[model samples]
Target chain A: MIVAKDVSLTYQDGTQALKDVNLRIKAGEIIYITGPSGSGKTSLLKLILGMEYPTEGHLRVMGQSMVKDEEDNIRKLRRKIGPVFQEFKLIRGRTAFENIVLGMRFLDFTPKEIIENSYMALERVGLKHKRDSLVDKLSWGESQRVAIARAIARKPSLILADEPTGNLDLDNALNIMDILTSLRDENTTVIITTHATHLIEDKEEGTFIRIQEGRLKMERRGVEAYE
Target chain B: MNKRAYNLAYFLKESKTLFKIDFLSNIFSIISIGLILFILSLVLLGWRVSSYVIQIVEREGEINVYYDLSLQEKDINYLMEDIEKIEGVSSTSLVSQDEAYNRMAEILGKEAGILELFDENPFTPFIEVKIHIEEVDSILDELESMLGIDYIRDNKNIIDRLQNILIILKVLGVLALVAIGVSTLIVVSHIIRQGIYNNRDQINTLELLGAPDIFIGFPFILEGVFLTLLGGVIAFILLKLVLGLGYSKFFTALPFLPLPAEESLLIPIGIFILLLSGLLGIIGSLFGLAKDNEKA
Candidate 1:
């Protein structure tokens, strides 16, 4: 779960990345953040990921305040959240299976759970056959799937995907969106940021928040959210 | 900690990958560290041998007493008896003319031909007195006060010089110890840092993936320890070979030298170097990780 109260973020170079953002995302909900290039969708994700701190106002992820001084606790908080980076961030020189398990090795899982989850995550993303393939040798689409598998394998409470459908063709983007949305389960919250608004336009169950310049406006389809 | 064991195979594989990434550089580092440790071992060997020799020499403190040969045999006997009666003197003996000549020839060995230029035996009868080294001064004073003793050749000057050499060797050993420690630490840590830099992307990925620093840095620690341990083994092997050669071939020429038994010397120093290298390996890796992670 994430809570943001009048949160604002301004970079050192005078770029207002977010301004007076107010929203509440609860556990077990699916949410979408859509905007144009440089529209602060990723910035909000970064804030939720604790990669950046708000210049003013308060923001908490999973009941923990996202502050620079709480770095160690922030790291512990990260363990509960799965993040699929825009660039994939799959480590090179490792197989797809290795990449998936790398995300779970430091968690509380046993050795058996680690292997099982890695196998199931790869199967879920339709990359089980390519598990042994090196990430560097994989195509861009395959790499993106590996990154998604890595994120989902951890079985995190919150899944934050930053432009998971970026650079993919229409079918692949739809596939990624399906795979990401299907990850939501009991006690899990899924938050996705993408500029491809068409992928979620027909989906009417989740809340939609639109951001422009530096402010966010939320439109709930059926779910009730925020204080 | 259980997680660490769970990832033990991965840690080893990652360390191997890191070493292979900079294979030639690591080999050079091992060789350089080995040579540094070898030099330190030599200084230690010199210190040990000198200390042992000085101890043995001190235990057998002796001085030569020369008197006028014109005295009758009975008077020489009296001189010997009087020397034995001195407070600190343990025992005394008179060296006859022929025995004194033979002793000189034995000492000179190959150089004894130089003494043949004399028409007859150039050596004269003298008293060989052995005393406790701590009582050397008192015994020498008593011998000097006795009559008909023309000269006393106490080994005080030689013993003092040997002690000075021992002190110098000890200083050199301590310096070598410090130098080996500092240089090995610097090289190992620098290499670990370099490996960290090379694998920064992997580290960053792991960090962002919620992996702990211990999880991320454990492979690097293993890599450093492995390399330095290898270096320690190499240093020990080279030292053993050198000492083996010393005892079997080189040192045979000077059989009277008081070098320590090879096993006694090698076993302890070998254990020390291996343990120190392993310990430094762990510390250096930690330093490298702390320094780089601080920047991040």
Candidate 2:
């Protein structure tokens, strides 16, 4: 769970990246965030990830103050949240399987368990065939799939994806969406950012929030409903 | 793998991984260090041997004194006592002219017949005085001022020239050490900095992961220690080889050569060199890693 109350971040040049933001994301709820470029979308994700602190007001993630100086607590919090960046952020020299297993290396997972769970996650993303392939050798869709496998491999409590399907075709986007939506069955919360309207139109796992000019504009829902 | 096996495997794997990255650079660093240290150690040992040899030669070629032929036994005895009282003389003995002629004859062996052509012994009734080597020049001058003595023969000029050569050698030794020390330090620092540059990304990742400072620095320190220790071992072997080669020429039968004594000092000296080399490595690494705080 993440809560931001009147959180504001200002750069040295007096530019406000995030201003007067108040939001709370509950456990096990998938939320889609749609926003334009420079709309504070990545800033919000960074705040929740504890990568940056708000200049003013309180920001809390998983019951710990985001501004606390305890580095151990921050690492522990990060271990619980798996994030997929727009660039994939995979270590280029490593194989796809190695990239997928990287998230679990710091979590005290046994090597055998990492291999097994990594394979299972790769199977879910239809990347099991490319497990041994180098990340640089993979196609864009395959690389995105590898990134998805890496995020889901460790069974983190919260999964954050920034433009998960931005560079993928429709079929690949649908495939990625299916893999992300499957997290709901495991009660894993998901937050995603995208401005690709066609990808999520009339297809929903939970709620949708839209933002423009660094501020949230509306919260809406599609035909899909929670039972 | 089982837990214990897995841990061992992981350690081996990581060590091998790091070794691949560091092995070639570390080897070149070690070899350069070893060659430099070996040459330095050889020079020091050579200088030490040469100094000891020079001291022995100077000791053998001591002052030989001559008195007037007319001086009697009583005069010779009085002169011996006077020479003994000289401040720098360690010991003195009176040699009658006849006795000196006889000794010279024995030295010349069959040529004594030619020396017998003289009606009388031409050798002087001298009091031969051996002075401490350090005070030879001053003592020679003092001996020359004696009123009744005809002449004093001391190899002070040769001794002074040898001493000058030794002084120059000592200066050269200091210069060599300083040059080698400076060059080795620069070479080691460059290698460590290259290592840091190569692993910069991994270091940043470790920092982001909240790794402790020691954990990040431990590997570099170990690298420095390993290279230095290897260099020291090579230098010790080289020193031993050099000593072995010249063992007979310099210290063959000299009782004061201290063969066993020197053997005892070898290990301690080798360890000291290794430790100093390791410290140099760390110094290089510290400078190399200083930039990380700013970049990270």
Candidate 3:
């Protein structure tokens, strides 16, 4: 669902976050981007989310060009992609149910569908018992799950999770990974970035990407391919 | 583009939460707006009353025309016909010396004993000419040129002063209206901006979730509208009470002034203020949203 050709990103402070990154991602594929801290893993997700534009090359997400002038189109594209921000970005003074359903309110879901899907997403993340709890009262792991529920509840075509496993114990982080991978189906593509490389070191399927010093290498497992 | 319909209850609930965030400040804003609008309503009431008084006075405009005592009854009849034919004159009728004396006694009320000191009636018979207020000067010129007319006495000074008062009241009313409009706009807009500032985090989250700008800003718009509408209702109540008391007092102490019926005046002005409040609420919210978006 994403195509990047010789993409490069430079910040206003002259920091080159990414250099000549080239990659192709198909629908329904589970991809994991593993790198150390400050290795441009989050920067790649930012480009995919249209939070930043490519400075030197072309990039397209879900058939919409990621460019400054295509703001409206990029906004529409965002509605089709569920993003789990590194910070979670859960709104305070709201219940977990409210936060989840708010993501689908402006989408094509009816009121009934919004409630049902919100509850279902909460159930999937194992937070149904805490659905009524305010996000501010929730623990760090609980907040992260609520953020993930908010993303998957919309049934987006693509899911991009930026550092979803940060500040979590091994069990909680693995549980988050399981929930994210389970969301991938015949029509959904899931791409997750994590600095904790051990989480996906034993994976048998899906695409594995490694980035170091602003350059990236790709390896595929199921297709027996390396790029 | 698949458009989704939002729940009205959801919007209202959101607005309620936003309002309660700073409940005391919002209550103060309502009181301030209501008091401002109340002042405007009082100005409008004064304008309406003074205009009505001017209208009644203009309609009753009359001048006294004195003629030579040597004229016979036929000559007086001819003079009356000629005065009625003038362009500005509405009608003419001769008042006898006895009738004038009786009018003066009625006006003097408890002081009519002053007229009994004279042996003969000192009042002279005259033709009372009713003319249009706007045509007073022309009519006076015509009356001065009439052959049998000895002198003409018109209340031009009183009429001119009344007209000047009407003009001043009109200008003051317009200035008060403009002041009310500008102050209300500024207050509502500032309140909306404050609401937006307080909810900036929620707004940013909504934006990242792909919510449309309209969806993100709808609750804030509702908040602004609700505050202004409350202000309007409070102003309406105060205006009604003041009008009731003012009308009763005027009827008791200044019965000569012509005032419109209470229901007719209050209903229209009440409706107008409420509608204006609603309109300003929407415009002010839009202005706040536009400024916030610019900053973003």
Itemize residue pairs with steric clashes in candidate 3.
none
For each candidate, the DockQ is: 0.49, 0.19, 0.45
Scored by DockQ, the top model is: 1
Model 3 residue B196 distance off true place after TM-score fit, in angstroms = 1.5
Overall lDDT per candidate, in order of appearance: 0.88, 0.73, 0.87
Q: Give one digit per residue, the lDDT tens place, for model 3 in B191-271.
A: 888889999988877877778889988888898889888888898999999888987775545443566788877887788
- A1-227 per-residue lDDT for model 3 (tens digits): 89999999999999999999998998888999988898899999999988899998999988899999998788878899899999999989899999998898889887888889999999999999999999999999999999999999999999999999999999999999999988775368999999898999888888999999789999899652542
Q: On residues A1-227, what C-alpha lDDT tens digit does candidate 1 reach at each position?
A: 78999999999999999999998887888899999999999999999988899999999998899989988888888899899999998988999999998899899899899999999999988999999999999988889999999998899999999999899999988999999888764567899998998999999678899999989988877544342
C-alpha lDDT (0 to 100) for residue A34 of candidate 3: 89
What's the fnat for candidate 2, on a 0 to 1 scale? Answer: 0.10
RMSD of each: 2.8, 7.5, 3.6
Error of 2 at A132 (Å): 1.9
- Show where candidate 3 strays beyond 4 Å: A224-227, B1-6, B59-61, B64-78, B94-126, B132-134, B147-160
Docking class of 3: acceptable
Estimated TM-score per prediction? 0.91, 0.65, 0.89
Number of clashes recorded per candidate? 0, 0, 0
